[model samples]
Target: MSVPVEVIFKRPEALRDRPTHYCPGCPHGIAHRLVAEALDDLGLRERAVGVAPVGCSVLAYNYFNCDFQEAAHGRAPALATGIKRGRPDTIVFTYQGDGDLASIGMAEIIHAANRGEKITVVFINNAIYGMTGGQMAPTTLVGQKTTTSPYGRDPEQIGWPIRMAELLSTLVAPVYVTRQALYTPQLVRKARKALHTAFRLQAEGKGFTFVELLSSCPTGWGMTPVEALEWGKEKMMAYFPLGEFKKPEAEEGGKK
Candidate 1:
């Protein structure tokens, strides 16, 4: 008798079969897969609506299988707020990069989370602006070199990198906020578990949920994919510690 073959790995149905345009070694693909898998696991693919504003993540609409809305630069949270408010039954989320979320869209994201919108947010922090020619972003390391900060980011002149997870956790309205990384398989599994928690909490009509993913940008960082991943684990994780900054208390009242 012929040996039978078994399939152990396959793409999640929540993600389209099309190849992604992300650079070779980019962690955005990993993040996408995790989100898609979470949606599949939670049976929220059909009800999910993703908002991708201008940034490296702007193309997420084409990658995900569910409904997506393109928003202006730094305005994804605003768009997601409207979507969730208009259609309360649908699951809503935003995939935003550091440049899009921590820079120009800072106000929008802060206000949305402050208002306690029942939506999930996936923040991808690569430090440098990946889609816009390696410019320095709000989360750029203090001594990191970017096109905008050729000499290096100076804390005295521009201030230190922002800790988004820690900052958001300070807000009382948000129900859950966590920081995870995609540098290693073990970390990736943890990140996926966080994603599942965020999505599941959103489904339960919990208040604002945010998961900040420490992602790698090899092209922008001018490093090989392997080097970038290592760099992120060593340098990026040092600045943005990975953990649950905030979580809803047991039976705590969550805003709808």
Candidate 2:
């Protein structure tokens, strides 16, 4: 008698059935998977609409199975706001990088959070620009060298790195704001839970939700994959501590 085979694990339905173009040790893939898993688990894939801005995840549409739209550099929040407002039934989200979110799009994100738009945002922070030849980003750590900061980022010369999760949490409109990392398996699990919480809040029609993921960029950082993870755990994690900066209250979940 022939025995039936059992399937143990599989890819999330929210993800496309193809390979991603992310570089080795690049945490964008992990970020994508986490978002996809959350969407799949919540049965929100059909209602999902992603807006990806310029940066390493500029081509994010190609990786997700749900509807996706592209936005100009540093304009994802604006586009996502329009989408969510126009189609309130759909779950709108923005996938942005530090270069886009903390740089030119600062005003857009802050106003969006302050307005309490019912949308979810996934911010991948790798400290350096991953798509534009490894340039220094707004979240780049002090003393870190990049193409733009060839001699290393000097706090005195340039302003200090902006902590986005904390900044957004200070606003009254956002119901949820958290920072997490993907350097190790344990941290990745926590990051996954954070994503789930953000999406769940968004689905419940809660106010703005944001999840900042401290990711690794091996190619951009000019380090081996293993070395990049180690460096990120040591350097990035220390600067961007992981945990919830803000969360919803009992009454915060009542709005539709």
- Prediction RMSDs, each to the true structure: 2.6, 2.5
Return the TM-score for candidate 1, rounded to 2 decimals.
0.96
Assess the local accuracy of residue 170 in candidate 2 as a C-alpha lDDT between 0 and 100. Answer: 88
TM-scores of the candidates in the order shown: 0.96, 0.96
Report the C-alpha lDDT of model 2 over 1-256, residue by residue, as the tens digit: 9899898988899999888888977888889999999999999999999999998899999999999999999889999999999999999999999999999899999999999999999999999898889999999999999999999999999989999999998888899998999989999999999899899989999879999999888998999999999999999888888878888666343233
Candidate 2 regions with alpha-carbon error over 4 angstroms? 251-256
Candidate 1, poorest ten consecutive residues by summed lDDT: 247-256
Over all chains combined, what TM-score does candidate 2 have?
Answer: 0.96
Error of 1 at 255 (Å): 18
Best by lDDT: 1
- Expressed as tens digits, the lDDT of each residue in 1-256 for candidate 1 is 9899998999999899998888999999999999999999999999999998788878898899999999999999999999999999999999999989999999999999999999999999999898878999999999999999999999999999999999999999998899999999999999999999999999999889999999989999999999999999999999899998888766333223
Each prediction's total of clashing residue pairs, residues at least 3 apart in sequence or on different chains, is 0, 0
Local accuracy by lDDT, each model: 0.93, 0.91
